[model samples]
Target: MSKSAVPVNLTDRLSQFSELWSQKKVAVLNDYEVKLAKLKGEFVWHTHEDTDELFLVISGRLTIQLRDADVVLEPGELFVVPRGVEHCPVAHEETAILLFEPEGTLNTGDAGGPMTKVAETLR
Candidate 1:
């Protein structure tokens, strides 16, 4: 198989795979997959059993709702949801993001909604 590009145009990279929840392979490292995700609305409130996930906002805005607070993220800012914390992510408008997580992370760790990506596939 060929390698995906490392330096990518965020807009174009995300356009290549226009699917919610499913992560497209932009580039890969031994422990992480560089992903571009376009999201809107809300996601299920979930938690990872033992792995933390990092969410980087490349465009637009995102809100991470935890038990006690909501953390807002804007372009160029990133947020990390520690393992075992039940949280839900919401986007009021169209959002583009880059996420870094361990190789096998259930996108919706707990209360997964309709857009949850159950299986990890490198597209």
Candidate 2:
């Protein structure tokens, strides 16, 4: 089997955009999508009832606030929020993160407010 020649540079792709809370698609694996997002402040409380959401911090810090406790992650760390669990992500400073989830997973999940965004492919 032959391997694909191109490699994705996370930093280079991240530099293409500057919008906070918006996800940019970098690649897809089977039915899932690999996305990069810049985050700051607090996101709306939401729950993905069908699939788990993975968050990998590429830079700065992040706090995944749950109903009972908060899970903090620094650079190079990751966390997965299980399905049906309510979660809110907070970042005091500008944070860069990679998200792995099923294709078409909404950024706002069930919240569906103004902050919701469609993950546009990074070209």
Candidate 3:
């Protein structure tokens, strides 16, 4: 297929990675990157001080737990977590999500730990 005509399938891209909480870049648009993450259990309570994070559920259910409330998301639903707002993501089962954020935004945010990853594209 022509490089520009190639299709990026969420289900297909999701099959490339199994590690929870780690993200794989699927596309780039100007200064932003499109990422896919497989989430299970609870993620670190973190805040992206420099950029807002957009989370779009592709399959299964996802809950964004904030200090004030929990935002529940299902397939095709999206929520944007504003910059610097501390939050955590929890998935009781394997959940797939699409994220849109500025390039270089770390997966672990300011709560960096072993989960911090050097961002790279998967396809």
Candidate 3 residue spans exceeding 4 A from truth: none
Clashing pairs in 1: 46-110
For candidate 2, write residues 43-122 as lDDT tens digits.
99999999999999999999999999999999999999999999999999999999999999999999998999999999
- Candidates sorted by lDDT, descending order? 2, 3, 1
Of the candidates numbered 2 and 3, which has the greater TM-score value? 2
Estimate, for each residue in 68-95, the C-alpha lDDT of model 3 and write its tens digit.
Answer: 9999999999999999999999999999
Using lDDT as the measure, the top candidate is 2
Which whole-number lDDT from 0 to 100 does residue 88 have in model 2? 100
lDDT of 1 by residue, 24-117 (tens): 6565678777777878888888899888888999888999999999999999999999989989889998888888877766687766666666
Would you list the clashing residue pairs of candidate 3?
Answer: none
What stretches of model 2 exceed 4 Å from their correct place? 1-3
**Which runs of model 1 end up more than 4 angstroms from their true locations?**
1-6, 118-123
- As for TM-score, the candidate ahead, 1 or 2, is 2
Worst 10-residue lDDT window, candidate 3:
114-123
Backbone clashes for every candidate come to: 1, 0, 0
